[model samples]
Every structure is written in C-alpha cells, then in structure tokens.
Target: MKKIWEFIATGFYSGKLPKMPGTWGSIVAAIFLYFFWPENIVYQLLIVAVTFVSSVVSSQSLSEQLDDKDPDSVVIDEIIGMEIAMLGIKATLPVVVAALVIFRIIDIMKPPPIKLFEKLPGGFGITVDDMFAGLYSNILLRLLIWRHYV
Candidate 1:
C-alpha cells in the first residue's frame, strides 16, 4: 500500500529522474492524456478529480513517511497540474506543447497567489500551487487557442 502511494507520489518515479523531475512528470502526464483521455468533458473532469484526491492522499503519505515538507521527488502534483492544464482542451501536439510550456513557466515563476498556496500544510501545500499554475496555463492556453495562436 505504501509502495503504491510512493509510486503515485513520485509520479511513477518520473520524479526521480535526473534534472527537471517536474518536467518529466509533466511529460508523462501529457503523454498519458494524449493517448488515453476520455472523449467526454465530464469524464475528463472526473479523471482529474480522482487524480486530484489521489495526489493529496499519496503526496501526504509520502511526505510523512519521508519526513520532507515538500520533496522534489513528489511530482504527482505536476501530473495532476499538467492534466488540469489540458482539461477540456484539444490534445493536438501544438496545443500540448504550448500548454506544457505555459504550465512550466507559471509553475517555476509561482506568480501572485500561485506562490501563496505553498503555505498550506502537507500535501495541500505541495499540490495546490501547481494546480493554480495549471489553471493559469489553462486560461492562457484557452485564450491562445481562441485566437488561433496555438
């Protein structure tokens, strides 16, 4: 059970990869969604919801077990965030690439309220910040898509 949580929290060990583990996690997530995402928006949202809860649970479990406030390797947050960024958006390569870039930028910069989410305790702290980044990316990507830029 703990092993399972560890796997989830680590984003299937994409988190352990050398250099930019979050990017690795995001790549894994983007690929997964590109291939396996549901046709319906509601179902896509359901998948994100389930993964969101799983992220909180698994990330908190791993954080407690490892005695880390926010481990670099706990990148399930990135997976969830990446999924959120692409939610209800078409999964074309250009769109995916644009969403990925935007998501990574917001996540790294942690602008405005996105940075504040890190103050929350435990896994909530670890995850919500990226969720906001993804949200920001989603909004920006939507605009870009609407303008036919992506």
Candidate 2:
C-alpha cells in the first residue's frame, strides 16, 4: 500500500513533524544509533550501507508517488545520513549531539559538492546530498574527538 511505503520512506513519520522535519528525523536516527548500534564497527558499517541502498530505492518510489523530485516527507535519507555520521564513532551524548548538529547544519547549508550531489536524478538526488553532509560532519567530529573538542 502507498501508506506503508510513505511510512517507511518518512522515517516512521519523523518527517511529518510540520517544521524542521529533517532535523527531527536526524535526532531520531541519532538516538536509535546510540541505543542499539552494533558493537562491531563492521556490522555498523554494513547497516549504514544497507540503509543507504534501501533509502535510495524507497525514496525514489516515494518521490514518484508524491510527484515530487525530493519530498520533505521522505526522510529515510536523513536516517541514512545520520547513520553515516555515527559510523565508527562512539555514540556518546556529546559526540552524538555534536554529530547531529553538524549534520543538520551541513545538510541545511548544502555547500559545494553537497549541492552538486543533490542535482542527481531521483532518489540519488534526494539521498546523496545528505550523505555527503554526514560524511563532512563525520570527518569534523572525528577531528574534534581527536583534539578532545567534543
């Protein structure tokens, strides 16, 4: 059913929060990552990879259904991006919160290659831009951790 697809594509309705739904989606994802992430980094990475692949597919479908190139109600991309940000990183309160903030900022700003990636067709357009934002946030968070900044 379309409702079922919408539910999954919306990241369990966090994307329907009416305002800053993307931020809400990222927060939920960070919480999920903190509480239930696999102890093994390999498995965590695998989950991120799987989430990314599946998000692309689901986002494309949802986009088509909504007749939009990138629907706000599709936040699987945010979840995937949050996972990318959390990858291989200890999910401490400070670290997780910082990653979430950084991800939100970068995702919102859409600087450089982040904007470029958003130009891709279909779900790749919807999902990859956030992925790059997550990658950027991850690198910054890693550096901050290395420097005891967060």
Candidate 3:
C-alpha cells in the first residue's frame, strides 16, 4: 500500500528518472501520443486533461513525501504542460520540434505569472506554474500555426 502510494505520487516511477526525468517523460509521452493518435484532436485533448489532473495530484503528493519545495525529480508537471502545449496542433515533425523547444524555454524561464505561481504551497504551486507554462506555450504554438498554415 505504501509503495503503491509512492508510485502513484511519483508518476509511476517516471518521476524518479535520473537528471531531467520530467522533461524526458514529457517528451516520451508526447511522442507516444503523436504516434498513437496522430491527428486526432480528441485524443490529444484527453491526454492533456488526464495529464493535467494527474500531474496536480502527483506533484502535491510527491512534494509532501520529499519534504522539499518542488523537487526537480518530480516532473509530472512538465509532462502535463507539454501535453497541453501540443494539444490541437498537428503532430508533424516540425510542429513537434517547435512545441518542444518553445515549451522547454518557457518552462525554464518561468516568465511573469508563471514565476509567481511557484510561490503557492506544495504540489499546487509546482503543478500550477508548469500548467501556466504549458498554457503560454500552447497560445504561442496556436498563433504560430495560425500564422503559418491558416
């Protein structure tokens, strides 16, 4: 039971990956999502929803366990944010590459309110900040797509 809770809290061990596991996890999840669903908006949105909720819950739980503030190891937030960034965008190689780079940059820089969100306590802070990052990335991606293709 304890182990199960830990696993769930840590994003099924994806959070435990060495180095920037969260980024890696997000990348993998995005790749898998693209391959599995391809151009399906429904599937992409579903993935975003699930990732958002799960990341919030998991980040909070993991923060409690670690007894530290927003440990880098717990990266479910990144995974969720990445999914949000990719939502509704075509899963083409160029788009995916652009989204990944943009999302990572925004996430790392933690601009404006995104940086502000980190002030919140525990998992809420961790997850919400990244969600905002994802949202920022999403908006930019949308504009880029619209400008170029639409």
Candidate 4:
C-alpha cells in the first residue's frame, strides 16, 4: 500500500530525479498533456477532477510514510497542476510550453493567495498551492487564446 502511494506521489519516480524534482514532474506532466489531453472541455475537466482526488490521497499518504510536511519527492501535485493549466486549451507546442513555464513560475513564486494556500496541513496544503498556480496559468492562456496571442 505504501509503495503504491509512493509511486503515485513521486509521479512514478519522476520525482526521484536528481535536483529540481518538481521541474522534472512538471516536464513529464507536460508530455502527458501533449499525448493524452482530451479534446472536449468537459472531459478535460473530468480528468482534472480525478487527478485532484488521487493526487491528494497519494501525496498525503506518502507524506505520512516519510514523516515530512511536504516531501521533496512528491510531485503529483505539480503533475495535476500542469494538467489543470492545460484544461480547455488547445494543446499546441507553444501552448504546452507556455503552460509549463507559466505554471512553474507561479508555483515557485507562490504569490498572494497561493502563498496562503501553502499553510494548510497535509497534502491539501502541498497540492493546493500548485492548483492555484495552474489556475493562473489557465486564465492567462485562455486570455491569450481569446486574443489570438497564443
């Protein structure tokens, strides 16, 4: 059971990579977006919903196993966040790349409410901040798409 949660929390070991595990997880997630992103907005939303619940459970479990507040190796949050960032948008090369960069910046900077989100205990705290970062990215990309900038 622990191993199963570990696998999920670590993004199937993408988080085990040396240095910048979050970045690595996001990269893999971007690739996942490219290959697996749904065409319908409704389905895209469903995927995000499922990912959100699973990521929360897996991340929380792994955090308990490791006895850490936010384990460095748990990157499922980043993966799901990236998925959310790409929601309802066309998965073009430029869009995917932009989502990746924007999500990472917001995630790292942890601005405003995102910073506040980090205060929650357990996996909710660990994952919610990235969810906000992804929301920001999603909004920016949606605007750019609407304006024909992206």
* lDDT on C-alpha atoms for all candidate structures: 0.90, 0.88, 0.75, 0.91
TM-score, structure 4 vs. true: 0.95
RMSD values, in order shown: 0.9, 1.1, 2.7, 1.1
Clashes of each: 0, 0, 0, 0
Candidate 2: lDDT of 71? 92
Candidate 1 overall Cα lDDT vs. reference?
0.90
* TM-score for all models, in order of appearance: 0.96, 0.95, 0.81, 0.95
- How do the residues 21-138 of candidate 1 rate in per-residue lDDT, one tens digit apiece? 8989998888887788776899889988888899999999999999999988999999889888998987888888898889989899999988889999998889899999999999
* 73 Cα displacement, candidate 1 (Å): 0.4
Against the correct fold, how does model 2 do in TM-score? 0.95
Candidate whose TM-score is highest: 1
* Candidate 4 residue pairs in backbone clash: none
Flag the better candidate by TM-score, 3 or 4.
Answer: 4
As for candidate 1, its clashing pairs are none
Superior by lDDT: candidate 1 or candidate 4: 4
- Give the higher-lDDT candidate: 1 or 3: 1
